[model samples]
Target: MGIEPKNLAGWSDLLEQAVKDTLIPSMKTQEYTWDTTDIVSDPKRLAAFVALSSAGESIQVGFSGEPSDVASVVSQMFGFDDLEDAGDDYSEILDGLAEIINIVAGALHRSLSSDGNNLQLSIPLLIHGEIVIQGKEEWVAHRLTIGDNNIDAIIIRGLIQKQKD
Candidate 1:
């Protein structure tokens, strides 16, 4: 089994901490602060999703926000005054977003592995549209506000199963 169902909340809390701890201090922009964690839909234009799997169970993490906000984050992460400085290329922006999710997943992976959860992380998937969650799937999403930007981090437990015909 993967993370126990009863321990999901605790894991989610840890995920929140991972995001805050990873971004708060290292970010170039200092005005950004921890806002709140709440259940929210995917309203952002860009998103990156990664998953951790162990013993046939999986936990997926998705980080999403607006393109401008994502660009801001990429700029901050790379120490660029603006993403435009790195060139106005769109693929670089997407890669930067993937890297952000990769960093957060790395942190979470270390924590969970330290606790004896032999988990393997999957490649980060970048999405440009909406994220749809099927019925019976457990989705725990949080809204994190940094400065004036709103980012959503979603945690999905269990594998997605297809309905029978």
Candidate 2:
């Protein structure tokens, strides 16, 4: 199941807090417009697009990077290290990336649903093959910046429905 529209506003607010409390502690926060895009088929892939900038500059923190590095940063915030060391395996690195996305999603879910109701989240699917974001024109991407990254961190939230034949 996906997130409902009525819950998105609260979700976004919670996400902002999660980022500040869990990811970037010294970063400034801002509210941007919320928008949606078409849902992709890949289950490993979470969210539509993510853009995080540090110190007003856009940094390319691709999933191809080291899992240890990612885990280290994330673990520091969450206080638990569930990621396994996979050495130089790219697939393992991708798995770590998916985990990070999941963590972020879970944090959002928790922030939105204060009643402790269960929020269903799809398994983290890898972004493979050809995939195009449908309804790109309808999306309002929000960006937030931290540290020296010139570009702002982006958060895109939208209601996604399955395409009918």
Candidate 3:
């Protein structure tokens, strides 16, 4: 079952903190804007998502960008000097994306689940090529722009609430 936060404001602040900590750890935290950019305009765009669940609610955290752009961000995370140094390994890039989501979700889970409400997480799922994400339209989703990477990160809070059967 998904764990729903009784206080939405507090939950949003935590989510924002997770995003800032995960994406901009090196630099000063910047304000994130509502993301409306079309990432799919680039044919090589890719997306990765990780599922997070608590006693009351479940959420998915995702990142979407062109493969090259994502590599650049991942390279930055790994202390690579430049995008070229990160190379064109799709497997590595996707793996890094999953790691990023994992870290962020883990942090959020820890803080919110401290009240004896365990928050569980699933391995991240990467989607590229022709896969269309179904049932996402009904999710309580938000997209935000982080830094200058030109990628949109998606946060989706699930509407279904039930303890895992």
Best by lDDT: 1
Candidates in order, TM-scores: namely 0.81, 0.44, 0.70
lDDT score for residue 95 of model 2: 53
How does residue 31 of candidate 3 score in lDDT? 56
Q: Quick one: best TM-score, which candidate?
A: 1
Q: What lDDT would candidate 2 get against the real structure?
A: 0.39
Ten-residue region with minimum lDDT total, candidate 2: 57-66
**lDDT ranking, high to low:** 1, 3, 2
Model 2 per-residue lDDT tens digits across residues 70-127: 4444344355545445444435445545665566656655654565444555555444
Model 1 Cα lDDT, one tens digit per residue, 1-165: 556434567667887778876865666555544434654344346777888888888888877777777888777777777574554355777788898888888999888888878889999877765666676787777776676667778788854321221
- Which scores higher on lDDT, 1 or 3? 1
- lDDT (C-alpha) at residue 34 in model 2: 26
- In angstroms, give how far residue 138 of model 2 lies from its true place: 4.8
Clashes of each: 0, 19, 11
